[model samples]
Every structure is written in C-alpha cells, then in structure tokens.
Target: MYYIGIDLGTSAVKLLLMDEKGTVHKVVSKEYPICFPHPGWSEQSPEDWYAQSIEGIRELTADCEKEMVAGIGCGGQMHGLVALDDQDRVIRPAILWNDGRTAKQTEDLNQRIGKETLSKYTANIAFAGFTAPKLLWMREEEPENFARIEKIMLPKDYLSYCLSGVHCTDYSDASGTLLLDVEHKCWSREMLEICGVSEKQLPKLYESYEVVGTLKPELARGLGLSADVKIVAGAGDNAAAAVGTGTVGDGKCNISLGTSGTIFISSRKFGVDAHNALHSFAHADGHYHLMGCMLSAAACNKWWMEEILKTEDYAGEQAGIHKLGENQVFYLPYLMGERSPHNDPDARACFIGMSMDTGREEMTQAVLEGVAFALRDSLEVAKSLGIHLERTKICGGGAKSALWKRIIANVMNLKVDVIASEEGPGLGGAILAAVGCGEFADVEEAAAKLVRVVDTVEPEPELAAKYEERYAKFRKLYPALKETF
Candidate 1:
C-alpha cells in the first residue's frame, strides 16, 4: 500500500506519494497567492488552498498506481484563522501565522488577561500571530464576521475537512491556536470564552497519528481515488517536519530554516519555560516539545538575494563569504517582526556596523550569520532551562547551503546532522498516514526504519570561540534597538 502526504504551506501546497517501503514515488507542488491588504497584515484564501491541494494531489499521483494509495495526511502552516459560516463558507481571508496586525489584541491578552494566566492555560503567552489574537481582532474590527463564525480551523485542518467531510484537527496543529490546553491535550475552555468562541465551534481534536475519517465518495471518485482512503489527523508543519526528520523521543532536536526558522526540542514530559519565551506544545509522537520560532529565517535570505540583490545565484554570492564570524556588519533577521523569545511584532530588520569598505560579500555574510545568531537566541533559552543540546538535525532550503550550515554549526556550537531525505512536512505527513494505516506499528518505528542521517557538520573550536564573542555583541543590539522598532 501507498500513502499520500500533503504539506499545506504558506506559498505552496506540496504533495508526496510514498510506498510502504518509504520510497517517495512522485512529488508535486501547487502555489497560491498571498495578499497583504494592509501594512503588518497577511491573508490568504482557504478556497484557493483547497483548489491547489486537490490539483497538486492529482498531479502527484498522476503516474502512480492510484489504487495502492491507502491514506492521506496533512502537515500544514499553523496559526492561520480560517472561519466558516453556517453554510460552511469561508467568512474571511485567513489571517496567517506571520501576520502582525494583532499587536493590540496580543498585548491586551498578555497584559489584561495576564501572561501568567495564559501560560497556565495554553503553556504560551499570546502572540500577534496566534489564532486567538486574530480571533480577538476579528471580533473587535469585524463583528459581523465574528458573529458568523460557526466553525474555526487552522490552515491545513481546513484542507482535511474538505477531504474527509469531517471537521477535525490534531493536537500538534491546535497548539499554536492559543486555544488548546497543551498539557492536557484538549481545548482550553477559558481561552475559548476569552476569544468569544464556544467549544462547539472548534474542530474535534485528535493525536496526529489517529485516523479522522475517510475520503468522501463523490470527491474520491472525482479524483480517481478510493472512498475508503483514510484521512489521518495531521500535525502542524513543524511537528510534521520533526516526524519527517526522526526527531522524536526525549531530548531530540531539529532545526528548520525555511521561510521561518525553528529549533524544535522533543521531550517526554510536559514543561514550560518560566519566561514563556518558547512554545510548549504537543508533539505528533504522543509526547511534548518546545519550539522557538523566528518569523524570518530563509525569508531574510530570500529577501536579500531576490528582492534586494535581484539575483538567483545564491551559491555564487555565498562563495565569496570566506570570513565566518569576524565580519563587522550585522543584520537583524526580523523581516516579519519576530516570534519565540522576543515575540515583538514591531521589530524590524536592521544592518549595523557597516564600514565604507564593507563589500557585498561581507554584508551577505552578515545576513547568514545574523539568522544563525537569532536561532541561537531560542537555543539559549532552552539551554537556560537546562535542556542542553549538543547537536540538532538540520533541514529546509537554508540547510542546503554549506556555508550557512557551517555558520550555524559554529555559531550555535553544535553538530549539524543532514538527513538523506529532506522532504520536510510532506514526508512527515506520509509517515503519519503510513502509521495510521498500519504500515508500521507507530511513528517512532516508522521513523527509525525510514529516516537516515547522511552527514554531520561538526563545529570548529576556534571558529566557535569567535562566533561566541560575536554572538555576545549581536545579543546587545536587539535590546538597544527595541524602542526604535
């Protein structure tokens, strides 16, 4: 039997087909538009997501034996608010995870409702990008839409609902919504009340590996698929990526440098940072995990390479960056404000310490090193909590750059492991689907058997020392410029 994994991302929905032996037969991607209606606001159409997802899945399985496809699982972008009315129509464009228009609402939640109370309820403080803040924003600014919200969902779960005809979400995805009781793995009733929503309005929650429902007869027939195809309750994108990388069980870590960056630490016990800097969420592996997210990681690199520099030759540009940590220039990778420890939506990207002789290579080196330093900010928080990490599995587009990987390994002073297949969340979703269909006994078993670490980048002592000194300087700039942003 075969399984399908759907990664419903911010810009594209990537579909992957995997056989029982964990071989990916075909993969396809379909893109959708993102709208910036106003400054600090991001939105997307859920209808477009559905359309593209179906189209991508069709293209993904076009040449394969469709009858062998047993199940489908989705790992999707987290924290987008997708509200539906009584007629099951999208009430508004989903406010995305990177959207920063909910600053006022987030501040209100943390200050008025109290951060301690929030941490107690959801194991997290309210952030501008969280679904709860977006809900509050809708209630205050668009009362009509708020009143019509008969159902609320995260982005990828919306895709699942359209496929299975069952409104459902997994715990891993729901964790980012500010509405789940993370420790208990259930809805936070007080949070629902605070958001002016009811428990009934939320989707039914399940562990990520659980089967939600089967594909609808009509829809399955339309796609030349079986109605009996199971739709497994999928995880949020990061958790799915963790599964894909075999970053399961206690003390395992995975670093993702996609559009956004994350340092995910898996654990068996439920724990929260006293300062609420990192997110304490349910893992797809039926455990708990801590995640630190930076709003712009590879996105910062993309901005510099494409929009600013206007070139596609990333390697050619990076090739000139011979100096690792001694560059005087610095860049703040806060292109979409920030998340994790800072949680400041107003934070903007910056470049400091540029000299008259500072060439393009030095500035570009700052961009890569800046991202590495920002990632260490979250890692530092984890270290303060005594969750020490000596190494982490690295993935995403940024990890493909050897120079960037080298910079990160030394900056964070940890071994960077590169896996054989860096498929991200699509592969994770496929693993979840396979597990749900009994292709393997559980997630850990499947990952142990399927995922393999192909290479490891070790940190050099002298370079690590230099980066440690530079990181100390990089840490001070954020505080000095906090009021400026």
Candidate 2:
C-alpha cells in the first residue's frame, strides 16, 4: 500500500508519495502568489492552495498504482486564519503565520487579559502570529467579514476539508492557535469567549496521526486515487518536521533552521515557563514539546547572500568566512522581528561593532554566528529549567551547510546530528498517513523505525569556551539596542 503527504507551505504546495516501508517514490511541487495589501500584512487565497494541491497530487501519483494509495495527510503553515460562511465558501484571504497586523490586538490580550491567565488557559501568551489575535483584528477592523464566519480553520484544515469533506484539525496544529487547552488537549472555553467565538465555529480536533475521514469519491477520482483512502489530521510544520527527524519521546531535541528557526524539545510531561518565552505545545507523537521560534533564520542568510552581496554563490561567500568567534563585527538576526525569548515585533535587523578593517568575510561570519547566538538565548532558558540536553538533531535548508552545523554545535556546546533524510514535514505527513492506515502502531513507533542519523558533528571544547564568551557579549547587545530600535 502507498501513502501521500501534502505539505501546504506558505509559498507552495508539495506532494510526495511513499510506500508502507518508508521508501519515497515520487515528489511534486506547485507555487502560488502571496499578497501584501499593507506593510505588515500577509494573505493568501484558499482557492490557490486547493488548486495547486490538487495539481501537485495528480503529478506526484501519475506513475503509481492509484488503487494502492491508502491514505493522505497534510502538514502546513500553522496559525493562519481561514474562515467559511454558511454556504461553505471562503469569506476572505487567509492571514498568514508571519503576518504582523495584530500588534495592538496581541498587546490587548497579553496586557488586559494578562499573561498569567492566558498561560493558565492555553499554555501560551498571545503572539501577533496566532489565530485568535487575527480573529480579534478581523472583528475590530472588518466586522462585516467576522459576522459572516460560520467556521474557523487553520491552513491545512482548509485543505483537509476540501479533500475529505470534514472540518478537522490536529492537536499539534491547534496548539499554536492560542485556542487550545494544550495541556488537556481540548478547546478552551475561556479562549472561545475571549475571541468572541463559540465552540461550534472551530473544527473538531484529532491526534496528528488519527484518521479524520476518507477522501471524497469525486475528489479521489480526479486526483487518480482510491475513494477509500484515509485522511489523517497532520501537525503544524515544526511538529511535523520534528516527527520527520525522529525527535520524539522524552529528553530529545531537534533544531530546525528553515525559514524560521526553532529549538524543539520533546517531553512526556507537559510544562510551561513562568515568563512564557518558550511555547508549550502538543507534539505530533501524542506527547508534549517546548519550542522557541525566531521569525527569521536561514532567511537572514539568504537576504544577505543574495540581495546585499549581489551573488547567488552562498557557498562561495561562506567559504571566505574562516574566523571562529574572533570577529569584531556582530549582527542581529531580526530581519522579520524576533519571536522567541524576545517578543518584540519592532526589532529590526542591524550590524554593530564594525571597523575600517572589517571586510565582507567578517560581516558574513557575523551573520551565521548571530543566528547561532540568538538560538542560544532560548537554550539558556531551557537550562534555567534544569532540563539539560547534550545534543540535538538538525534539519532544513540551512542544516545542509557543514559550516553552520559546526558553528551551531560549538556555539550551543552540543553535538549536532545530521539525519539521512531531511525531507521534514512532507515525509512526516507520509509517516502519519502510514500510521493512520494501520501500517504502524503509533507515531513514536513509526518515527523510531523510519528516521535515521547519517552523521554527527561534535562540539570542540576550546571553541565552545570561545563562543561562551562571545555569546555573553551577544546577549547584551540586544538589550542595549532595544531602546534605539
């Protein structure tokens, strides 16, 4: 039997085919446009997601035996608000996860409603990216559209509803919406009241690997698949990536350096910090995990290498950077305004400590080290809780760089393991599909059997000591510059 994983990303929909044995057969991707109506607003058409997803699935399964396709699962950009009216038509464009138009709404929720009460109810403080703040923004700015909402769903849930004719979301995805009682794995009544919504407006929740519904007969035939194919409720992008990297069970960690960077620590027991800096959310493995996210990760490198440097040769630019924690220049990786550890939306990217002798190499090395140091800020919080981890699995586009791997390992004083398959959410969705079809016992078992580490990068004690001093200085720069920002 076969399974299909659909990754509904912010910019594109990617589809991949896998057999029950965990071998990938084919993969396809389709791109779409993102609209920026205002300076800080981001939106996308739900219709574009559905159309591209259908096309990508058709291409992904073109050569396979359509009758053998057993299930379909999707992992997508979390916290995007997708609303439908009474007739089930989309009310407006979806507000994306990176959209920052809800600053006022977020401040109101975190201050007036209070962070202590929010952490008690949802295990999280309100961020501008979360779905509830987007709802509040809609209610205050576009009350007419808010009044027409019959159902509220996340990005992937919209695709699942279109494919299976069932409005559903998984616990791992719902955790980021600021609507779920994450510790109890249910929708919070207080959150519903606070958002001016009822429980009926939300989609039914399921475990990440649980089967929600079967594909609609017409839809299955159009995509050249079986009507009996199961539809599994997949997770948020980060959680799905964690599953793909085998970062499940207690005391395990994975650092994802995708568009956004996250330090993900999986745990059997639920926990939240007093300050609510790290997010306590449900994992795809039916457990709990804490994550600290930076708004921009590899994106900073891309912006620097491609736009400022006027070259696409990332490796060529990085090849010139040989200084190890000795450069005088320093950079702040706040291109998109940081999230974790520092919830400042106005924090802009800048360079400091440059001299006349500071060449391109020094600045380039600072860009990489800056990201690593920022990630360490979150690790420092984890250490404060006395939950110590010596190493973490690394994935995403930035993880492909051996130089960055060494930098992160030494800077964080942890061994970094590189996995054999770095497919992230697409592969994890396929694994969830396999589990939903009864091919595996559960998410943990499936992950243990399918994921493998191909190599490891060990931290150098001498370099770790050097980065320790550099990190001390790096942490201070942000605080001093906050007033100026």
Candidate 3:
C-alpha cells in the first residue's frame, strides 16, 4: 500500500508519496505567499494551504497507483493560530510562528501570570509566537473576530480537519499551543481560562501515529484515492523530523538547521527545566522531548550571501571560509528575534569585534559560528537537566553544508550523524501514516527500519577547545545588548 505525507510549511506545502517498504515514489512542492501587513508580523490564508495541498497531492501521485494509497498524514508548522467560525470558515489569516506581534500578550503571561505557574500548567512559558498569546492578541486587537471563534486549530490540524472532517490534533503539535498539560497528555483547563478559550474550542488530541479519521469521501473521490484512507494525527515539524532521522527513545538527539535552528532531545520520562528555556513537549514517538528553537539560523547566512553580497552562490561564499573557530569577529544570529534560552523578541542581530582588517570571510565565518554557539546555549540547558548527549542526527537545508556540519560538530562537541535521506518532516509524516496503517508496530519501529546513517562528523579536540572559548564570549554579547534592543 502507498502513503502520503504532507509537510505544511511556512512558505509552501510539500507532498510526498511512499510505499510500505520506505521507498519514496514522488515528491511535489507548491509555494504560497506569506503576508506581512506590519513589520515583525506574518500571516497566511488557510484557504491557500488547503488548495495547494490538494493540487500538490494530485501532481505527486499522478503517474502512480492512487487506489493503492492506504493512508495520509501531515507534519506542519507549529503554533500558527487558525480560528474557525461556527460555519467552519476561517475567521482570519493565520498568525504564523514567525509573527512577533504578541509582545504585550507574551509579557502579561510571563509576568502577571508568572512563568512558574504557566510552566506548572502547560510545561512551557509564553513566547510571542505561541498560539495562546495570539489568541490574547486577537481578543484585545480584534474583539469582533474573537467573539466568533468556534474552534482554534494549529496550522496542520486545519488541513487534517479538512481532509477527515474531524477536528483533531496530536499531542506533539498541541504541546506548542501552551494549552496542553503535556505531562498528563491533556488540555490544561487553567490555560484555557487564561486565554479566554473553552474546552469546546480545542480539537480532540491524539498521539502522532493514531488514526484520527478517514479521508472525506468527496476529497478522496476528487483526488482519486480510497474513501477509507486513514488520516493519522500527525506531528509538529521538529518532532516529525526527529522521527524521520531515528532520533527516538531516551538520550537520542536531532539538530535541525533550517530557516530556524533547533536542538531536539527525546526522553522516555517527562522533564522540564527550571527556567523553562527548553520546551518540554510530547514526542511523535509517544514519549517526551525537550526542544530549543532559534528564530534565525541558516537565514542569517542567506541574508549575508544573497542580500548583502548580491550573490546566490552559497557554496562559493562558504568555500572561502576555511578556518574554523579561529575568527576574531563575532555575530549574533538574532535576525528574526530569538527564542530558546534568551526568549527575547527584541534581540537583534549584529557583528562585534570587527576591525579595519575584517574581511567578508571573517564575517561569513562569524555568521556560521554564531549559529553554532547559540545552538550550544540550548544544549547547555539540556545538560543542566542531567541529559548528556554525545551525538546527534542532523537534518535540513543547512545540513547540506560540510563546513557548517563540521562547525556544529566541534562547537557543540558532539558527533554529527548524516542520514542517507534528509527528507525531514515529509518522510516522518509518511512513517507515521505507515505505522497508523499497521505496516509497522509503532513509530520507533518504523523509524528504525527507514532511517539510515551514512556518515559521521566527529569533533576535533583542538577545534572544540577553540570554539569553547569563543562560545563563552558569544554568550555574553546578548545580555550586554538586551537593554539597547
């Protein structure tokens, strides 16, 4: 049987087709526009997501046997608010994860309500991008629309509801909403009251690999697939990517260096840091994982290489960066504001320790090293919780760079494992679908069979020591500039 995996991303929806044997048949991507009505705000139409996902699926399976498609699953951008009215129409454009318009609401939650109390209820503290904060922003800024909300859905859950005609979300995705009691795997009534949302407003929660409902008869017929095709409650993009890379079970780690960077560590037992710096959320594999996300990662490099340098040759620019961890210049990778340990939306990117002799190569190396040091900041938080990781599976577009991989490996002092297939969330969504269809016993089993490690980047002692010193100085720059930002 065949399975379909949909990665509902910020910029586009990528669809993938796979069979029971873990072979990818086809892949199709459809891009959509992101709206920025004001500075630091991001929005997208849910209608666009649905239309393009449908179109992409048709193209992805055009030459294949559509009737053989047994299940469908989605891994999507987390924390985007997709409100619906009683008639099931989108109430407004979705507030994206990169949106930073909820500074006031986030401050109220973290200060007035208190982080300790919030963490006790939901195992997370409020960040500007969290769904609960967006709800509060809507209530205050758009009262008329807030009064009409019949359901509050995450970005991907909106797609699942459209396909299955079931309002549902998985634990891993729900955990990002700051409305879930992650330790207990249920909705937090306290957070519901705080957000002025009710229990009925939320979708029913399921584990990532559990079946939510079947494909709607109309949708299935129009798309040339079976009506009985199961739609599993899929995962958050990071969690799905972790499963795709076989970073399941205790002590396993996965580092994603996409537009945003993250360090995800899976654990069999529940754990939360005192500062709540790292997100303690349920995993796609039916366990818990701690994640630290930085809003800007490879994006910093993109800005330097494309916008500043006026060139698209990322390899050519990176090829000039030969020396690792020895550059005197330093950069702060806070271009889109920061998350993770800092949690400061006002934080801005800048270069420090530049001199007359500082060249493009030094600035480029700093951009790369800056992101690595920031990732290490979160890894330090995990280590504080007594979680020691010596190796991590790496994925995403940034992972394609050998220099970046070597920098990350040495800077974090961990072995970086490169997988043969770097499909990330799309592959993970298909694995979840296969597991839900009983093609495998569970998520971990499916992952073990599908994920393959092809190479390893080991940290050099000398390079690690040099980065260790550089990281110490990098950590101090953010605090020094926090008041100014």
Q: Sort by lDDT, best first: what order? A: 1, 3, 2
Q: List candidate 2 stretches off by more than 4 Å.
A: none
Q: Estimate, for each residue in 1-485, the C-alpha lDDT of model 3 and write its tens digit.
A: 99999889887898899888888888899999999899889899999999999999899988988889999989999999999999999999999998999999999999999999999999999998899999999999999999999999999999999999999999999999999999999999999999899999999999999999999999888988889999999999999989889999888999998778999999999999888999999999999999999998888888888899899998988888877877999999998788899998888899999999999999999999999999999999998988888999999879999999999999999999999777788889999999999999988889889888999999999999989999999898998889999
**Candidate 2 CA-lDDT value:** 0.91
lDDT of residue 121 for candidate 3: 99
Q: lDDT tens string, model 2, 1-485?
A: 98898888877888889887778888898999999898778899999999999889888888889999999888888999999999889999999988889999999999999999999999999998899999999999999999999999999999999999999999999999999999999999999999999999999999999999999999987877888999999989889889888999998999988878899999999999778899999999999999999888888898898889999888998898777979788899998677899988778889999999999999989999999999999999999998899999998779989999999999999999998777788888999999999999998899888888899999999889999999999999989999987
lDDT of 1 by residue, 1-485 (tens): 88999989888898899888888888888999999999988999999999999999888878888888899999999999999999889999999999999999999999999999999999999999999999999999999999999999899999999999899999999999999999999999999989889999999999999999999999999999999999999999999999999999899999998889999999989999999999999999999999999999999999999998999999999988887878999999998899978999999999999999999999899999999999999999999999888989988778889999999999999999999777779999999999999889989999999888999999999999999999999999999999998
- The 0-to-1 C-alpha lDDT of every candidate, in the order given, reads 0.93, 0.91, 0.93
Pairs of colliding residues, candidate 2: none
Model 2 lDDT at residue 13 = 83
TM-score of 2: 0.97
